[model samples]
Target: MFIFVGCAGGGTSSMFCQRIAKAINATDPNLTATFGGVNEVLADPIACIGDHDLMFAYGSIDVVRGYSAFDFGQLFDAILVAPQVKYLTVTKQKIMANYPTIVEDIPSEIFGKMNGEVAFEELRGELIMLDLLRGYQSSLQTASKNADKDIEILVLNADHRNQQLAKVFANWQRYGIRVLTETYTLEGLYQFDPPADFELRLLFGATMQLNQQDFVRISRRIDGLIVFSETPKTAFRDWRQQLDDADIPTAILDARMLEKRADVTQLSAKLTDFIQTVEFQAEATAGQIRLPKLQTKKAKKQHTLFGIISWNSTIK
Candidate 1:
């Protein structure tokens, strides 16, 4: 077994997994499978090809103990981390990720608007995520010829910065990743009218506060796999019973509830293929780096992490 994790344009990755499942199933009938491994891994893609199991999860397995979805290198034959711009790194550990998404998400809108009053203790900056991705992509583009491996780009942004975002896209082209043309959307946000309230006026920007809950509530809608057996006493057993009977590993990824955001998928496949396969040289990808925005803080958390930056994924 092999495990690869990262921020992939859901479209291509989804199709890729489906196609892989098809090809794999053709080789053997008993191999169970499932698709859609997000920041975390999962059980299976198809219903009945093999046992349901997850090959990845949140956090470094070696650094932090106690996890059901880990120890892939020990249990499986190979390990892969197809991370987006940035992911935490624990050296000497077999586990890895495509990118590092801080399991944390606080609204930037609050810090920007705060009516200039909300005191935010220097948590982190927008560039922290973006810069890592840019450097990661730049490093990878410098290494591989496949272009598929080098397209790993990542970023974070203010809701109103789409104008500046145009400039961001332009910069990526300079790096060879060309995210605007390569990336695909993971999640698309729904528009909702903000509720009228006075507290929002003081705590956060009216535009953000009004719509925050709407975004958070939408989190329950995830693409998890389960089934019913239509049984007697309990009404029915889950269809995954076969997988359970086989004792296959499983991991659930709840991506529905993150910061309110949207997806962008209107990109060319030629670009997507190029971006996914890029990588960096051992010497360059070996050390640590910092984001410009963190310059003010003399004491900043500097830990080696994995990252990728592709423009086409989150633009919507």
Candidate 2:
């Protein structure tokens, strides 16, 4: 079997892809795995058609929604239209279970002030679109009197990754790195806030250049620094010199290198646990599927999900 994995660019998807390859290989040694960014695959679906038996797409609902355009939607529609794709897997809930500390740190308000269940349903809607596409494909195939391909849509609950990541965040003093970037592309790294025990910060190159005082302030706060390969050395010369003068630990690595060293290793250890914890269920098309018809009840708001529960308000 041939499998394709896609996600938003940056290391999360790539790291997950590695773990997936290892897992799939362990189970069925004959299967082949291929990986690419979701946008790249969507942009060129023709090249992918008939080339793979399964496709796994990863990302937040926002990431998936960003790809929804007249033509782009058509591209995704084509995937289901073709008989080559036998299975499609995507997430239906937050990767990590909710924990009190995580809830307090990340703030559900960012997700439109939603309760965990509502937020999950909102995210799951994106995947429902995929289910609908598959249903449409099934209908067409049945209409033609062709043997229906048992196309399975696997909705993965990835709360374990979140739970494990919370552990990582809780122990950020050991795993956290102060990353310097030139743009907001790296903001995704901070989606989950780190614990207060570590001084986790992102310094924009231009901002530092314009405000030396702020640069100096942040530099002193950091005990170590990591710069991606794409960082302009000349622009950061003074900052690097300051780091050297302060005798701080520093390493310069390619963007991909940073992801592997900092993210993949920490996350891979949690994959087995993630796989073991995953719960799967079939879902109906978008219109037919109804959000849980329950009244939004007010209760004491506490950050708790998966296994990360906050006992106190203090993050440390």
Candidate 3:
């Protein structure tokens, strides 16, 4: 089989190709391997599809499948190849520094030809997993584009600074999902520029302490909610009670019993699944909505409506 090994840049792929080719060619002279930068190789469909039989794709295979020359009917397959497993310790450390979430437990050095084959085989699984994640991201993008209504989400946090959550928000935004991250402070609610519209809001963090008035205000803003139970504040309990009473579509994340906070991956996956499955219909007005205060009995009777729709009448 003809295989093309690629990396972010052509340099690493060259070394990998040399080693892989030497190992495979020793056994079967018919099998060949080549190297190139991933973008350059994937961009030129003629060279990639005409000369090579298979591509050792790193992430989502959508790009390869999109190739016009690719024949799906033929014996074609996308194989995932991870080069990190065979990397030197120093190189791995540098990679981990940038990608703190990417953790590889297995340690194997490819010293001999046999070791190279074994390491490559083990690394294949990692590539496949990466492909699956990329596929998930692609699905989100497609769904967002095709959705009749804009999909926007609010991420509530007590702490404003969380690198992991920021990355997750950024990823969702890249997939065409509008994200608004906010934190509750003594000063009041603080958030960056929010989306123009949102039908769904999700609440998290320990200090999102809400009073009865605060609860009523939020109920008007969101149609669906995913509430966490581990928070020490009674406001979370109150919020859940209100949502349950209103019969709103809500998902409860019970982390009360856990000894520690849930890691970023676990929480992000849960949020993603919830977003994908639920259909939100509540119409949140696209500006500041405030309930006008009523001082007199006549005013209370006249104010039958709530939010921006509320208006006053002339007694004439």
Candidate 4:
């Protein structure tokens, strides 16, 4: 079986596709998986839909909410017309649930005016109609394309951000990127050794309050820091000073900047430059580098709930 997974962005969704491919490949030697950004897939819907046995649509809740019934009809119809597709799976709710930071951060007023159940049913109805129309259109598009194939359409209503995060971490591990925390001790660090040819070394940390002493210790090993924009400018200033004192570089990223597709592309370019500069500086000061040996401890992992959706239909 050949599967094509399309996501809204390259960061989280790309990571999720990698994990799905890994898990599927491990269990089924006969199956293969590939992934791309959703816009890329939509640009040539005919080829994308016709070539894959299964097409997985991964999007945030905002994607669904932003689309009107008519717009969704066209999208749903396009996918349904693909003769080779046996399954059409949507994992939006799962995506929202996986990202607690996104959920909890949402204002209550946003939910106050809407009825959740009613909205969901309306969306589901639109999707079902699209499926029916696709079945009707299939015969006109391709005479030999699996007219008897069973097609399944499923929409899962559960959290998904955590699953995406798991994929992100897994990818980081595969690429040798170490994940560390703001904890003062060294043992609290989670490290990934990048490939020997990898040029940049980075450390990602998040905290409500950054300790200067801890920052000093972490800067010893990492060439730079990943700081979120949500952090106060005052805290960022202190962290910057500490990093500068230790001769380490810093990149301040806004988590919200990812909401817009265009911003995501721009951010990717900026990050690439930031990483290259830090790596160059680190290489120049290689002889003077001295890593600290702070105490180590096992990091505790958090657990969360996830949901799955599946559907089936006989091709006419």
Candidate 5:
């Protein structure tokens, strides 16, 4: 199977592969299948994956999902590190496809050491980074693993190599997870010509970059455009209203805001009347923030527990 790892194959993807290798025998009938990874899973170990038929690893170059044929290892002949000297050549190799930029002056191993460990502090002084350093990534990533962040419990588009009607069905089945799967073929091949970037500043948090094609793409994919940010942040009502105006599907994942705030209850109640029960996990914890805050369903449920012991005290 083609094991497609993602985003510069880092510690997350590598360790994840090792975790699943045990229970899933590669020799099984499942061929050309895929193994998905989040920020923590790595797609490395593919070269060694004997159970599967074909293997593919994606992500930044760290410990796992090392590199491929078009990778830097094979690109010594072209794409030098220096800029402005600009020696552009036309070869079969797609330059963007072979990244892992000839990492600066530091030796590969030393540089690897520094990038391997990333940490940041949040509300509770909690530091988050890749769980799997060099060890195999554990295979226990739940939809709630990174409950503290605006984590999207959505499945991504799986391996798209096999071009067939069946392939589309498989993609829908895998990525349509919990209703996150989407399909809208581009009218034509498209690319973001000039690179795009942005900065995100929070009142209580530092200014960070909401800069990725991924986020840009989200704008188009999500209809009604409510709930701009990922999770935990107070909903930008104006933004959410705009999305509601556009009529998009929505859900609330940030459990923290769900606790103290119930303004969205009106929207939830509407959802309750028309549709079947939603798919939600009881294990959900309070965390996350998103913008625009408008993904109205059939119901905006506003339920509260209010009780008083009105009876006279009885002898116990």
Candidate 6:
């Protein structure tokens, strides 16, 4: 079987490609895995994923839409950080049914830091599970050609590798909230995926230089938007205003939030509440503007949450 993985820059996807390729080659050398960037695959799908058995694309919904135009046997958005139980169980059953030989025993010490043979075996299991889950989801949605996402959130962060931000995104996924940022890292890839009727895509503004048309396209689709900036006062005010003018739900967060899990958790909760509610009136508090608390969902949602978190950077 051929596995093709594509991400915005191809860095994260390439690493996963290499790991899965190494594991698969140990047992079945005939199987192959490859990686490419968003532009490369869109420029030439046949050259990047020719004769592919399955394809996984991780990025914004636009990236997924561009890829869905092709005729891959199975295409997965690869956005679910933590999926529901039934879907995960079905994924495992399919893998066991098809590739029982690749399965290995789990070590008793699977909870914490592991090393030596235990680490090796555990990593192997993880690769197999991820590989199978991608393919299984693709097969389930083979009939549909459209990218059916219930909610799409755009995140702008200075560092894509921020551990606190990573945990926040994972928690949001655990609660069935999908996200989008500018770019992704290996650590991010390890903790992400999307479910049917739900999706997550990352587009970090600090890394990816988005043009006017790019912003226009993205602005129309996103349900909620949050930005984490080191210098929010100077860097994000104008752009934030532009989004606010367009009536897009936008929030400007202090980059220091990336330093603590609790802060990020509070930010995530605010975003989640914003996504579910229908209206919001911005309020400022404690040198940090809270986005919006939960209003009622009975009426249509108006993208009006304009929040900003600014304070002395030295506090961090």
State which candidate has the highest TM-score.
6
| TM-score between candidate 1 and the true structure | 0.20
Off by over 4 Å in 3: 1-160, 185-208, 229-239, 254-264, 277-279, 283-316
**Model 6 poorest 10 in a row by lDDT:** 307-316
Using lDDT, give the best candidate's number. Answer: 6
Model 3 clashing residue pairs (backbone) = none
Q: Which residue ranges in model 4 land beyond 4 Å of their true spot? A: 1-185, 188-203, 231-235, 260-262, 290-316
lDDT of each: 0.26, 0.30, 0.38, 0.35, 0.25, 0.41
Q: Per-residue lDDT of 202-293 in model 4, one digit per residue for the tens? A: 32334532455444334434556656464435446654655566666666655554443334445556555766676576556653533332
Rank ordering of all candidates by lDDT, starting from the highest: 6, 3, 4, 2, 1, 5
Error of 3 at 308 (Å): 28
How does residue 37 of candidate 4 score in lDDT?
Answer: 47
Candidate 5 lDDT over residue span 77-128, tens digit each: 1121111111222221232332221221112232232222221001001101
- 1-316: candidate 1 lDDT, tens digit per residue: 2223222334433443454444434443433334444333322212221243222222222222112122231222122222331243332121223222222222434222323112112212332453354345434422111112221222211221343334434554566533322121222111112133211110101212213223211211111111111222342134235323322212221222122342322222222332232222212333222111110101112342112221211100
| Model 6: residues with Cα > 4 Å off, grouped in runs | 1-148, 176-200, 260-264, 277-316
TM-scores of the candidates are 0.20, 0.23, 0.32, 0.31, 0.18, 0.34
How well does model 2 score by local distance difference test?
A: 0.30
Q: Candidate 2: lDDT of 14?
A: 44
Q: In model 5, where do residues sit more than 4 Å from their true spots?
A: 1-144, 149-268, 272-316
Please report, as a residue range, the 10-residue window in candidate 4 with the lowest summed lDDT: 150-159
**Candidate 5 Cα deviation (angstroms), residue 28:** 33
Better of 3 and 4 by lDDT: 3
Q: What residue runs in model 2 are displaced by over 4 Å at the alpha carbon? A: 1-10, 29-31, 48-50, 57-61, 66-133, 136-316
